[model samples]
Target: MNAEREIRGSYWLETAPGGAPAPPPAGDVSVDVAVVGGGIAGLSTAWELARRGREVAVLEADRIAAGVTGHTTAKLTVLHTLVYDHLRRTRGREGARLYADSQSAALRRAAEVVADLGIDCDWEEAVAHTYAEAPEHVEALRAEAEAAREAGLPAEFVTGTELPYPVAGAVRVTGQAQFHPVKYLRALTDDLKRHGGTVYEGTRVTGLTEGEPCVLETDTGVSVQAREVVVATHYPIFDRALLFTRLSPRRELVVAGPIDADRAPRDMYITTEQNTRSVRSAPHADGTRLLVVTGEHFTPGAPGAADVEERFARLTAWAQSRFPGLTPTHRWATQDNDSTDSVPLVGRLHPGSRHTYVATGFGGWGLSGGIMAGRLIADLVEGREPEWAGLYDPRRLASVVREGGTFLKNQAHVAKHFVGDRLPSVTSPAPEDLAPGDGAVLRVDGHQCAVHRDDSGQLHAVSARCTHLGCLVAFNRAERAWECPCHGSRFDPDGRILQGPAVRPLEPREITSH
Candidate 1:
C-alpha cells in the first residue's frame, strides 16, 4: 500500500462500540419530521423531536457520526478560538453575549442528556484556556476575557501556569466540557431509537418537493412524506436558495497519540497563534490518556496537497518535538462550513416558511452549535418560537454586508477555482504518474479526469469536474479522496459520492488496468 494512503482511523471509532451498519430505507414512509444527515445536528433533532411526541425519521447517507461529528476534536466549549473580542468588535457586545449564551445553553443540554441517559462517555468538566505566546497578544486575550465576562460567560484573565511551555497571558473559562463524541452520539442514537424515532442509514436524500406534505425523494427510489424536513447534512444537499454561495468551507486536521497522563494538563487549551494548536486529552480503553491536538485549518482543493501536507507534517513534527517520549498515533482530517459571518446558519430555509429547515455553516464550533441548532429547528417544527432564533437567522444578511470585504473575497476565491479549474491544462501528470493508492488529475480520453492507482496496481478514474457546480476536484492525500473546492462536494477515488451538495456520483471515466 502507498504510504500516502495510510489510513489514520479515528480514535473514537476504535474505542466506541457500534452495531452493524443498517441497510438503507427500502419502502415509502411518512413521519412528522424527516431529518436528513445523521451527524450530531440531525441526531440531536431526532432525539429532541421524538421526545416531544413527534414521529421522526433520520435519513443518513452513512452511519451516524461517520461525517464531521466522528472526526471532531469534541471540545464542548463556548470559547471558540479568539472569538469573543472579535465578535464584540464586529457584531457588538450583545451579539457576542448571545453567541456565548446559546453555546452555554447547549452545553447544559448535553449535561442534561448525559444525566437522563446515564451513559458513560468520559464526560468531564474542564477549564478552557486561550493563551498567548507573544507579549503583544496578551492584551487580546485580556480583551477577550472581559468581553466574555460582559457576555455572561464565566471568563477571566490570568497568568497561566499549567502548561509546561511559557505563556505571556491567557483568557480562561471554567466549567467547559469534553467527551468521547462518537461514544456519546452512539449512545444518543440508542436513546433516539428506543423512543420510537426511526433511523435509516445508507439513505441518501436527493431532493425535497415543497408541498403541504413535503415529499423527500431519496436515491433509492423511496419517498418520505413529512410535515416538516430538516437539511442537517454537513453541506446542505441542495442550494436552490444559494446557501452554498454564502458558506466558506474550512478543512482542519486532528492528530492524537499516547501520552503520559501524569504530565498532561487537565485543561483543554487553544493558543492565540496564527495557526493555533488546540490541545486536549482523551482516555484510551487501556486506562492511558491520548494527547489529542488539532489545528492547521485551511481551505481544501486549493491547488495541491503540498501546502496541506506541509502544514500537517509540521503539526506531526511539533507533536514529536514537544513530547519526545510519546509515540504519535493518528492524523485525520475533517472540514466544516462557516457563514460569511462566524455565526452558524440555523433557521428556516426561507422567511415565512413552515416546512423546510436547514442547519449548517457551524465553523469550528459545530459540537455545541449542532446541539443549539437542533433545539432551534425542533422549536420551529413544534410551532414554538425559540428566543435565539433571530440571532442565527439564515436570511439575515446584516453580517454579510457588514463583512462585505470578507464575504466578497470568499466568493471571489470560489469564482477563481470555478473558472480556472475548467480551462485546458496539459501539465497534469499522466495516469501512470500516480502511485498505488494515490490520485491525480490526468488527461483520460483527452478530457481532464481524476485518476487513482489502487494499492493492488489497479486504476480508478473519474471526471475531474465536480458534479455540484462543475468546479475541478483536487485529490486529498490524507483522506484518499477527491475534494471539490467551490462547494465542498467530495468523491472517492472510484467516483463514489462521499459528501455533497452534489447528489450525483462523479462521472466515471473508463480506466484500463495498468
Candidate 2:
C-alpha cells in the first residue's frame, strides 16, 4: 500500500451504519432528564435512566456513537496503562481499590447489558497488557502489576508472548474485553427508545438556563425543559465550572487493517512508549481480525507540533514495522480530554450547579470510564449516593494540590498557545501562497482569517478566532479542519462546527482571491 494513501474512516461506523436519522425536535420539548451528548457516556446514562422509569431524552449534535466513541480502540478493562500504581501513590491504596472496583463493575454492567439485550457486538473476553520495551521500565511494570493486583484485579507481571517483537516486561490482567463499540451502542440506543426515551439527532444545545426546570436552547430555536440535565458532550460545552483549566485535550491517530486471526495478538496491549501505542483487535470477515493500533498523541493544533499528516504516517509506519506484512486499510483520529488528576469528572457540573451535571475528562480510556460515568451520573441524578462518587466528583479540590505539577504543566502549555498564537511572528501563509486542498491562518485587513483553498481552487475564509475562548485556530491539513489547541473545538473548512465545547461555527470572513 502507498504510504501516502488517504485511509478510510472508522471501521466500526463503516460496518455498523446507523439507523434511520432521528429528526431534531420540531418545537418545545420536556423531559425528566436531558442528556446532551450521544456518545457512550450520554447514551449509557440515558439508557440507565430510562430503564429506571425516568422520562429521558438524548440530544445529539451528530449521529449517536459516531464521534469519539466510534473511533475508540474499544478495550473494556480495569487496567489503564499503569493507572493503579499512579493512583496508589497519589490517591492511596483505598483510592486505587475504588478505581479498580468501579471500572470492573462498569465492565460487568456492560457485559450484562450485552447478554440481556442479546446484542452481537463481537464481544470477546481477553487479557490486557501494559508492556514496556525498554529494559529500564521493567521495574515500573512489576510495580504496576503488583499495584493492580492489590487493587483487586487479576494482574501479574509477565513477559508477553504474542507480539512479533519482544518486550522487556508486561503487566498482564485477565478477564478484560474488547468489542465493536458502534454495534453495542446502537443496540443500546434502540433499547433506550423502547423504554420511551427520546433521542434527537442534529439538535445542538447552545444555551442553558439553570433553574427549577433547566431550560436548554437548541440551535434550531427549540427549547427543552428538564428537571435535570447532563452535559456529557465530551469536552463539556458549557464550562461554567472552568473545566478547561483542569482538562487538556489530546488527539491521537489510529491505523487498522485485517490480519489473519492466527497471526494477530489475542490480547489487548498498551504502552506509554512511542507517545502511547495502544493495540487491540476485533472480529472481522473470514476468520480475520482487524488489527488496530493507536498512538502519536499530541494536543490538537498545538503550535510547533508535528504535522498531522506526518503523525499519521509515523503511526502507520510503526504499526507496519511492528507487525510484519500488516497492511493498514483504515485510518481515523480521536480526541480525548485528560484531567490533571487523571480521573473523569462525572457528577455535578459545578459546585454552584443544582439541577445540572457534567461528565468529561475521561482521558484516553473512555470506554470503561464512560460506562462508569453513566452509572455514577444516574445514581447522582436519582438522589442515590454511590460510595465511589467522591473519587470522580468535579468539585474535588485535594487532587489539585497532589497533582499540581501536572495541572501547572497543562495550564502552562495552554497559556503559551493562548498568548503566543497572537504574536505577529507566528505568521500563516497568504491565501495566494496556498495550493489546492490546503488551509492556513492568514492575516487579512488586520484580522486573523482561517482560509482554505479547495481542490477546485475556491477559497473558503473564516475568522481564525475560535468561538470557545477566542483562541486562534490552527489548520489540521490531514483532517481538513480548524482545531483549537486550547479546548479541542473543531470546525470544518467551511466554518461548521465538527466537535466542540464551542457551540457556534467559525464566522465567515470576506476575502478576495488574487
Candidate 3:
C-alpha cells in the first residue's frame, strides 16, 4: 500500500484518534489560552482552563492522541523505575516526599477526572511492582521501600512472590493505577468541546510570536490570537535551539496479547535489568486476560523496533513457559524525552518569554508527568503558586554533577550535523515511484534533499540532514512526518518544525538539476 494509505489505514482503521478535533478558528478569534498539540497533555490543559471559565482552543497537526500517548502501556504508577531511592539520595528526604506526593496526587486526580466526566476508559487499580533479578539489587529495592515509607506512601518489599520468574526481591507500591489512554482522552476531548473549547485537526501550528495577543500561525496562513500559549507539544515548539542541549529522546516498546486468567498475575511488574522488562495484565472484553509486556534498549537513536520485537518474543516465550497458551496479539513503540535531571520541566519556556509555557522531559513517565504538568500549567496561568513550582522550573540549572557534561555532549551532537556537511547525489523519480502525499530522500546535485509531492503534485524539497543534530531524519510513514533518530526532533513533510530541539527548520535544499 502507498504511504498515505498506510497511515490512513492504521490510524483510520485500527481506532479513531483519541481527542475531538476543534473547528478551525474563523477570522480573528480570541481566547484566554491557545494550546498546541491535541494529545492528553494539551486536552487536559485545555480542560483545566475551560473549567476556570477561560476560552480555550487546541490546535493539532493531525488527529488527537496520534503521537506517543495513544501508543503507551498506560501504566499509572508512582513506582517509576526505582526513583524513590534516587530522589532521596539526590534531592533529599523532602524532595523524595514531594515527588511521591505529586505522583500519587496525579493518579488520584486522573481517577477523579474520570469519575467526574463519567469517562468509560476501563480505568483500574493495580499493585505497582519493581523487581530485580540479581540478589545484590535487592538492597536497592529495599532502599526504595524505605524511601516510600518515609514519603508517606503505602509500600513494601517482597521476595519470591507473585511472578513467573524468581526475583531476589521486589518493591510493591500499593494503589498505583492503569487504563486505556485513548478512552480517557476521548472523554476529555468531548468535555472540552462541551465547555466551549475549540479543536482543529489537520491544522499544523508553524510558529508563535510574543505580543499583546500571542499569534499562533498555521501552515495554511491561518492564525490564532490568544492571551497565552501552552506548549504541551511533548517537545517544546519554540526555543528549540536552547532546549535541544537540555533534553534527549529515548525509545520504548509495548506488546499486548492473551494470557490465561488463572495464570496471569494481577499486579504490574518491571525488572531492574539494564534492558528492562515490564509485565502487566488487564481484563479483556471477553473476560479473558490481556497481558502487556514491555522493555528493551533505552538509547537515543537506537534501532528499537526490532529490538523491541525480540524482547517481546522473549517475554512471551517466558510467559508461555510459565503459563501454557499465552500469546501476543498487538505490538507498538513510542519515543519520549528525558532530562539530565529526573524531574520534568514545567514552567515558563524561558526567563524572557513569560507568556509562553512548556512541559517536556517526562522520561517515560508521562502518566504522572502529564497530569503534573497540566496542573502546574493550570496553576501558572491562573497566577496561583504551585507547591512544586520551584522543583521543575525549566531554566533552573541541573544539580547533578555529570549534567554539564551531558549538556555539552548534546551540543556537540548538534554541531556534528552542520560542520563540514556534503550533499548526496540525486536519483531520478520514476513515474510510479513518487506518489501524492509521499516523501523520500533523493540526491539533487549530489546533496541529500527530502522530496515530497503533495496531492496537487507540487514537489517540496529541503535538506535531509536534521537541523537539531546531524542524525539523518527518517520519513515517518505513519504520520507523514520527518523524525530524527538521535534526538527525536520532528518536522512536517514540508520542512516545517513540528516538535523540536531543532529551532530552525531544514533550509530548502538547493535543488540543482543533475
Candidate 4:
C-alpha cells in the first residue's frame, strides 16, 4: 500500500471537534497578561495565570491546540530520548538533576490539573524506553540509563520490551505518560475562561513594543496592552534575542493507525536510529488503540517531494513489518526547534527585555517541555523564581559557549542556505514544464517564482523568496506547500501563510504562458 495515498490528516484534529471560534479583538484590548500562541504552552500559561487571579488573554494566530500541539505524538514523559547523559556531561550532575526535577514536576502538575478539572483526555500512565537495536550502541544506552538514574529517575537498563522487534539494550524509565493533547488543552481553555481569562482566535501578533505596559500589535490592526507578555509561538515569532541563531528547526513526519489493544506496545518508545523513531499508543474507539509512529527528521524544504514520500513509505513499512496488519490511516508532520545546548530556552525573550518572556527549543519533546515552560513563565511573571529557571534561562551564556560548536554549526547551515540560495541557478525549471498537481521554483522573467499547477491544470505563482528572511522557498509536494529550508516558514500554493516566523503572506507573481 502506498503510504501517501493511505494517509489522511492528523488523527487528533479529525477526532476532536473544535470549539466555537473566538472573535479577534475589535480594537485595543487590555489584560494583565497576554499569552501569544494558543498551543499547550500558551493555554497552560494562561490558565496558570488565571488561577493566580491575574486577568489574562490568549492570542492565537489559528485555533487553540490545533498547531504543533495538535500534531504531536502526545508523549508526556520526562524521559526525553537520550538527553540525561548529554545533560550530565555538558551541565553538571545538579543541572541534570534540575532538568529531571522540572520535567517531572511538569508531569505532576499536568496530573494534578487533570484530576482537578476532571478532564477526560484518555490519560494513561506508562513507562518510556530509549532502545538501541545495534550492539555497538548498547553501551550508550547503559550510560544513559545510569545518568537518568543518577538524575533522580526510576530508570534501568533492560533488554526486553513489548515491541515485536528485539533490542540490544534499552533505558526504561517508569512514571511516564501519554494523553490526548487537544482534549486536555481544550478543557484547560474552557476552565481558563471560567476563571475570567479571555481567548482570541485568528489574531496574529505581528509587532511588540516593550514598556511598563508592553504593546502587542496584531495583523488585524488591533493592539493588546499588557503588563506582561509571553511569546510561546513555538518558534518564537519575535527574534529580537537572535534566537534564530541558536535554535535549529527540524520537521518530522508521523504515521498512525489503529491496532488491536492486545497487540499495541504497553509503553512509549524512541530510538535515535533511522533518523528518529518515536512510538506510542493512545486509546481509540472500540477495542483498538491508535499506534503512532514518528520519524524522518529533516529541515523543512531541504528534501524534495520524492524524498518526503520515500520517508513516509519507509516509516509505514517499518511500522507494518514490526506489527503485522497495522495500516496507517493518518500521516502528518510536526516542526520543532532544538537549542544549541539541548535544553529548552524558557525565560526572558531577550537580554534587555523587562516584561517579555519566550519559550522555545524543545527539540522534539514539547509536550512536557511546554508545560514546564508554562509553569516557569508563570512563576517569573508572578515575581517568584522557579528553582529550575536558571537551567532553562535564555540569557545563559555559559552553555552557549560550551555548546559553541552546535551553535556555529546551525549558523553555518543557515548561512549556506541564505547565501547559496541567492546565486542564480543555471538550470531553473520553466512554469510550463510543471505537470498537473506539481510545483517547482522557476525563474519567471528575472526573479525566482514558486509556481504550482493544480489538478485542474490551473497555474499558481508566488514569489519564491520567503517573507521571513529572504531565503528562497522550495515546494513540498507531499504537503502541497512552499516551505523555507531556513527557519521552516511555510506557505500555501496560493501564497497564503500556513506557518510562521513569517507573518506576511507570499507575494503573488504573474507568470505569462510562453
lDDT: worst 10-residue window of model 3? 4-13
- The candidate 2 region of ten consecutive residues with least summed lDDT is 1-10
Displacement of residue 92 (Cα, Å) in model 2 is 0.4
Cα lDDT, all candidates = 0.85, 0.91, 0.74, 0.91
Best lDDT among the predictions, by candidate number = 2
State the RMSD for candidate 3.
5.1
- TM-score (C-alpha, index-matched) for candidate 4: 0.98
Count of backbone clashes for each model?
0, 0, 10, 0
The superposed Cα distance between candidate 4 and the true structure at residue 221, in angstroms, equals: 0.7
- After aligning candidate 2 to the native by TM-score, how far in Å is the CA of 59 from where it should be? 0.5
What local lDDT does model 4 show for residue 455? 79
Candidate 2 lDDT by residue in tens digits, 1-514: 4455556889989998566889999889999999999999999999999999999999999999989999888999889998999999999999999999999999999999999999999999999999999999999999999999899899999986588899999999999999999999999999999999999998999999999899999999999999999999999999789888999999999999999999888899999998999888888889998999999998887874439888888898999888888888899999999999999998999999888999999988899999999999999988997989999999999998999999999889878877877787555567899888788889888888999998789999999999998888888888889999888999999899999999999999999986
Decide which is better by TM-score, 3 or 4. Answer: 4
What's the lDDT for residue 254 in model 4? Answer: 96
lDDT of 3 by residue, 121-189 (tens): 778889988899898898889998999889888999988668877888888888888887877887788
What tens digits encode model 1's per-residue C-alpha lDDT throughout 223-286? 9999999999988887766778789888888888887777676788888485768888877646
Predicted structure 3: lDDT = 0.74
